[model samples]
Target: MRAKLLIGRHARLPARLLLLAILLGSGPAGASSQPPRRFEDPLCHVVEWRTPPERIVSLSPSLTEILFAIGCDTTQVVGATRFCNFPPEARDVPRVGGIVDPSLEAVLLRKPDLVLVTRGNPLEFIESLVRLGIPVYGVETRGRLARILATIAEVGAVTGRETHARRLIERLQATLQDVRQRTATLAPERRPRVFFGELEGAHWTAGPGSYVHGLIEAAGGENIGSVAPSAWSPLSLETIIERDPEVYWGTFGEEGEAAARERVLSTLRNAAAWSQTSLGRRPRLFLAHADVLQRPGPRVIELLPELARYLHPELWSRDGQ
Candidate 1:
């Protein structure tokens, strides 16, 4: 049977063994069959079986969102992390555990035919699942807008919905490319120097090798502190004063814009030299939802374009050019 065609059906072990034996008997001696796609990681491999997997479990919230986006049957998603709370429908799925530490007992009890997990899942947990003869599929995608789309396609291909996945990636790439073109119109001199702070207290900023650094550059702004080797690093007021960024971007989970602004300003103003920088005098502040921005998912296509408009109003047209 063509394995690709049977994407999401569940097959029992005994039946699969019987089918394998029959295929071996029918073939000429010493003949070899085509190998199933091997993902290299021991935890996730494509199993050639009598049937495909019907029940699925997702360990990461980001992956869960991607799976649902590819049109997976919600009822078939029997288990998910507690944080996998998007699409409203996910809330109804049984919570297996947190991302890093999942409840193996809960997962085993669900009797999932296929288990989906991302790169950072615990090795021990995956080993245990493997010992039980469970089929697990592991996916690792870099934190970029395109990778998110590729992940959609990858998941779709495995679940026999590659067509749907490809279409989704095409739409997403088009939107991002359009935004990139609009951003490119800005003259280098006109591009403002911007700083993206993850939190107020920590003074953490996204820098080199980070996906957001790419986002900031694509949006036609210079990331003031991205020269650092790490993607995220702590920034002191002295460093802020030295760079003198034109815009200060941050994510906050609080009520009232005035209160939030005051809190942020107070922290910066405490450092006398830093307060004198270009940002403190006339700052263009950008705020985003923490979960949406922090998690590397499909939302960045929607997130970055709006931020570009805010940072470089003159470059973009009245209809968000």
Candidate 2:
């Protein structure tokens, strides 16, 4: 059966996402006068700040999105990578190269008092920034959902948006609970075997410890990549054929979702090897919003329910939900 088409339903941003101008238009809470307070990153680097940072640079797209989500935007977020395009305003921010090859010179030009990065960033690169006396904060981003929430709280604390962070966390946890509670009683036969993620003609599959692995399970589907070695691994084609995933779930980018979906379908249809699987015969292609589904950012809450519905429309039907 064709996977449920629930993409367009979530196209509209929730009211909370539209509070940027109202919440941050006047700028940070004017706490600059407060005495310096202690702050630290996941890497354990401490910096005493008198107030929320006025000028900040984000080295990763996930960090950039989190900053914008918690009412911190252009005025406070002075620089970001080219990939940080979201909320339609991040594009206006100056570019500081990429996570691995970020231009330190470009970052210095922004005169940022704080720079945000992820644990996935190169240690040497982070050290280089620190050696120049640039204060850096690195948050956890490459793990499970709990780590994502913790990162949001950390970003909010450092940016003085702790309240917004808590709200976002509550929503995510609620959605997670709702999905799991609703799907927990499914019969064994109801949970389909699924394969998620493919890159460069190989399976960059999600394994046991990964966020995507947990996501598929929470939505009541058995992840076929559970036996793979790590969170993300390129499984051999022979192993994929042996395991035989019935459903194929993939993520599409900002490029109009329709066109991207068709491209993926066409590629799979044209490939002979794909035609051998149950996914090819059944034609159950589950497409996910790449930014929301893959990026460990605040926007992920937008895709949570949609993903659950796609996997088990019987339990999460539109009107019923």
Candidate 3:
């Protein structure tokens, strides 16, 4: 039942090093106090949005969604990357380009007062913008749940929506606590053995260091892919068959679970490949929205109950737990 955490893996900055230094102080019994007026980013640069920004740009879809969630609108968020298509309003923003290769010229044209980034944003891009006198702030939101919560608090301060951010964080905390309380009471052996990975086009999966891993554990399931070497990696079909997970689940881009169902069923039924194993006899599919499962943002909290319902339906069936 023990899994090793591979922190560094294939990232420019290791997940541990990418941790944000937000000022969302901790209170008694795992609660958060009021967010401070200022905080420090991963770059060790201090950030304080003394005046609410009139124009903002988001480098990632997750960041863009967070901006909108914290009371920011099209007027305030003037530009975002092409991949930011959530909340409908985001699609209306001017395209600054993709996350990895954004157009510097396009970013400059938007005349944003602030730019928000996630752990995946390039350090060089941030520095280039800073050199041009634009304030750039980032959040560490890859695999860590605590870091994601911290990001919500920090973004609220940046957008001057501290109350909104705190409320969201509190709701997220309450849900997490409820799930933890439920899972804690279950004996370890009783939890389901689960696998959460892409089975449509590829065999990619989340390892022990990923939020998916945390989610699987939180939902009372043991991640069969925990043996994978890194936070995100590919697993061979042979290995998956050997492990023979009791459940299979994943997401396909922004299309969500329903979009992924046919593809999954097709693959599992392909020439009776999956049926040859124990999984085919007792198939349990739990598809989720990629935006919630794969993307690291405030909305990932929404997956908590959805995943638990599939993993442990008995609790919900009896008392709606």
Pick the TM-score winner.
2
Minimum summed lDDT over a 10-residue window in model 2 is located at 1-10
Model 1 RMSD in angstroms: 6.9
**lDDT score for candidate 3 against the true structure:** 0.76
Best by lDDT: 2
Report lDDT (CA) for all predictions. 0.72, 0.78, 0.76
Across 1-321, the per-residue lDDT of candidate 1 in tens digits comes to 236224223333778645655654465642445423323222335544333457889998877877777777577788999988876898888999998999999999889987888877897898788778887777774555556776777677665567778877887788779778987877888788888874246678787777788788888898876766587788774576687788877776546566667766776577665577787787668877666666666776677778888887766666764
User: What are the models' TM-scores?
Assistant: 0.80, 0.83, 0.81
After superposition, the stretches of candidate 2 with alpha carbons farther than 4 Å from their true spots are: 1-35, 267-272
Backbone clash pairs for candidate 1 read: 9-52, 9-53
Model 2 lDDT per residue over 119-223, tens place: 656788888888889888888788876778888888888877889889888988888899889889988689988888882377788898888888888888888
TM-score of 2: 0.83
User: Quick one: ranking by TM-score, best first?
Assistant: 2, 3, 1
Better of 2 and 3 by lDDT: 2
What's the lDDT for candidate 2?
A: 0.78
Query: Native-vs-model 1 lDDT?
Result: 0.72
